[model samples]
Target: MNGTLTLDGFCHRLAADPLRYRKLHPVAMAGEFVDHFGVPPFPRMEGIAGLLDRSGIGTVVLSHETGGLRGYHVGTRDGGYLIHVDASEGRVGQEHTALHEAYEVMRERLHDLHPRIGLAAGISLCRQADRFAAATLMQPYWFAIFAEASGLDVVALQASYGRSYASLTIRLAEVMRHQPLLAVLYERGPQAERPPGMPGQVSEGLRATVVARTPGFRLRMQRRPLSALRGLLPRRGAPPPPGSVAERVALTGRPAAVDRVSGYDLWRADDLAVLARPVIWGGQVAKVSVVAVPYRDRSVLLPQFANAAFERTFHAHQVL
Candidate 1:
């Protein structure tokens, strides 16, 4: 499939055998695509541009004006593609939009099959391109290594990878599909309601908490008081401790290191400690944190939880 796994090809495959493609991880597929194109690992912005140029995109234009539309891609008279990005959206947003447009341009088969492909197919293709761009920007292997090394801190991972919080949050969910011990929470405001599209309901006067966890881990959390801590879901009763790391980070927009606490401080577990960091969005503080059973092994200093797949993959790739 070298040099041939175009966006349209992936969409066709997904349409023909939805379950098969659904089971495959987006990051892994994107890594394979990069490897096939011979792009360097952990490609930077310039590298991504180069890849786009090679994939048939001719020019990338950035507009500083703020508008309703983030960006768009269009075919020029010369049969080349031009991508226009909204620079006003900032660096991370511009990068994401550019990559998404580039992927759209690379869907050579889509143009050929446009007349035959209906609206549903077109939507699927668009969704596939979005995922492809995200995975390309945040390569799975690099992200996995960074997650482990950075103690699963979303802010640190965002700095290291130069990804937007939204992108990093989505990628975290993708990574959690393989790492059961991993979970990420986004607390929007002091008493923010549950984020739109997130499952479960929050208790009155509580802040929003969107939890993303692996299936088994989520099931285990569900069996306990932490059931409300399920993926992107809110807790059913009571707010977290006011002095808890999550609350402190939300209020102060600062990082906090805390010892294990009782009664909904985090996961309702006595053994788990937390490192909470504020996720700043639109100049406002959004509390985000990483939780894990504290590490007992001398080999690692930070919390080390059991994740066989993550351990095997990390060791095999020498990412740790």
Candidate 2:
């Protein structure tokens, strides 16, 4: 392969023969990094976090009285990293956001790897490798086992996994890419359809915009209750609802709106109130969005700082 992996080719390979490639490249990246830098093995998230700390990526708690959203990152003048994660997002019980941030950091470092490929290919590989790594590490089968052993539902999963609704939902979707049970759960969940006067169909542009604008954008997928899968693993917790607003928007095909002011109130209550709006495309709601609200006393707004930075940098090059 010699690291010539094209994005479209990698995606096609993943779709065509997912299992064979599932643990291949990301694991390769890990192996290469360890061989080059002599880093210790990371058997779990905490281990990876520790590795990041040693690699000069600093993890810090960011407190700004915002109530709705979870985690984000800031760059340091010294070219190091500072990750700001909300404690509220932590309440969702999974570590999706943290993992996402960590993946980003990893991608940044991948660019600095020796004998680098062309910029376009290198960046694409880095991001895809991060996704691949995350999917491999948090396989849905493992989640099923964990949920069974621990008795965690969506709410409990949030508690145990330390992930937010959006992150967890997206993670579940990623898991479905490999596991049949998760695939079934995702397929059987409620799906959204557009109203007659709405957009005709969904598009990638619409999806990106909605995701960019929404808070907790990850939560729009249907989640499976851990309690129902007891026989597949071992049983543990009470079940919660299976679907989220993103899933609902996709299923109902309706454009939804959220009042950020009211959302602020919920946020101030420390409830991590996430508000979502739908992006209409081709006569349908193409995507659902979520954003964390600041405290009740504060004004509701886009995560301007983070969003602006992401918009400026994300996809800066056609290859990335």
Candidate 3:
């Protein structure tokens, strides 16, 4: 992403360097930017701004939004672009918007050249731009570096990385962490009372709202319709069993690792084992993060989970 690079000429570069670049996907393109520019690990606003500048795009942070739009970009007569992000979205949201608008503005250039395009192409382009934004903002190579210290603590990662829960978690899933780990982040669906000692807690009955995992790891008997992710918790599922470790963690932010000699399974799956960790914000359990691994036998030893990068090993099992 050199300052000379222009949005209008992006397609031309793809055509000119077909052999060098095999795919036109935005995620791949964003990766190219990350690699090409040597974007620093754990980038922040200044870093992202540098990226935008390198891409020949001017930026403006507006205190107010326009027509409910969080961000938008416009082409300049000088054959470059200028992106504007509304400050109302907060720091994290603004960073995301800035990166997202950088990709989204490319669509305007494409549409200008081709007055009309197929419906599918337009939809595909938008999706690609979204992916590009995410991939660029969160460099995958940094995962290993971050994990070395904090492990795969999603709450800490989300906060430290300055990303939304859904964005960071989904990016983790997409990048495919090295270990065979699947971490699901979820919130309580309904409640009775905050378990004793867990003050300010509001709810019970945990339900998965976001999912992140290494490739191919899944719950047994999932239908995987539409998308493999939808089948994870919403389909053919129930809340973690009452008195189960998951229920305990959800009700109370205490971590749990238990061996099911003949105990509870979130859903009746023979292979689904779990370890529940509470994600706390402001001293209340905002949500729970589940680290699942495949293991069985009387010992209930979690040898398979050694590489999952938890700060401490999980002795038991979990559900999101």
Candidate 4:
């Protein structure tokens, strides 16, 4: 079997013997998933796109008006997958989806190899594979390092890992020298102690004061107050629906989708303000925080940063 036949055969084989094929695959942290697949980690998914391109698959960003739907991966008979993702989610999120699609393809191939193997029948095996892939790609180890380095505690850990939000805060805290922030937040006890909205909505006055007191944190206020959040407008359109991404982040004290602004440091500028710098001892994001920026200001800042902060922060803290 070669070319089209080989591809078809591979898919069929996986479908036939899903268990046997899945068994051979290695599992690690989410970061390892990217590494093993010859792609970059979550926050840097261009590597994944590059890999897809090399395989003759085109990853395009087409508007919904152009018959493009979000969150669907369409595989061409020629052995390529065309993945449509929301522009807002960007490459990191999209790459995770792509990896998921690839895993399905691999599964099909495994089943084809052993027609009698039913991964569906072996629920444990299927679940284990998924956990392995998610854990590997999420790179919890790196996340742990960045968290500790930043001085984050269990409560802060929820912000970094509990939600679907990107995990860059830990790493950014490490790089920015904000371990004390994490220390302070953790020392404050469980986040449950604070009013639900309080932790995520640090005031600007508080931000200024905390940074002022923590000289070692290395945060320099940009000469210009950050470009206001209004800059993210869709050009003369209604603002995002009520309960938008920023709103969610603010309420949860967790990094949310809004953190993926194109230029801002996702970890430092989102709903959770930067009171301190994150540390990256070893290869992960450690504990870090600041006095907390007001929810409104942090909301504004989120539009300018990329998701890199999540991975950077998480990786930095995890090492610590």
Best by TM-score: 3
TM per candidate comes to: 0.63, 0.35, 0.67, 0.36
How well is each residue in 45-85 modelled by candidate 1, as lDDT tens digits? 56666666665554777776536678887788977777787
**Stretches of candidate 2 above 4 Å error?**
1-50, 65-70, 91-94, 115-141, 144-194, 197-320
The digit string of per-residue lDDT tens for model 3 on 1-320 reads 44326544554454456453344466777776566556676567777877667656555555475568877777678777777777677776777777777766654554565545212255675667667777877777776555434445555566667776656666766665555555666675555455455334323545566656676564443443455433133322234434445556767567765443121244434444556667677787776665554444212224323424323333333333
The segments of candidate 4 whose C-alpha lies over 4 angstroms from its true place after superposition are 1-35, 41-43, 55-70, 121-133, 151-320
Q: What is the lDDT of residue 24 in candidate 1?
A: 34
Model 2: worst 10 consecutive residues (lDDT sum):
311-320
For model 3, what is the C-alpha lDDT against the true structure?
A: 0.57
TM-score, model 4 to reference: 0.36
lDDT of 1: 0.53
Off by over 4 Å in 3: 1-4, 15-22, 75-80, 110-130, 188-206, 218-246, 259-273, 296-320
Per-residue accuracy of model 4 over 1-320 as CA lDDT, tens digit each = 13423334434433444373444453422333344344433444566556545544345443344244334556678756565655655544555555544454455545555666544435554444444444545464566564444334223444454422222333333333433232222111122332334433321111110112222432233233645333331111121112333222223444432222222334544223332233232542222232333233344233223322332131111001
**Model 2 CA lDDT for position 209:** 18
User: What's the residue-level lDDT of 70 in candidate 1?
Assistant: 80
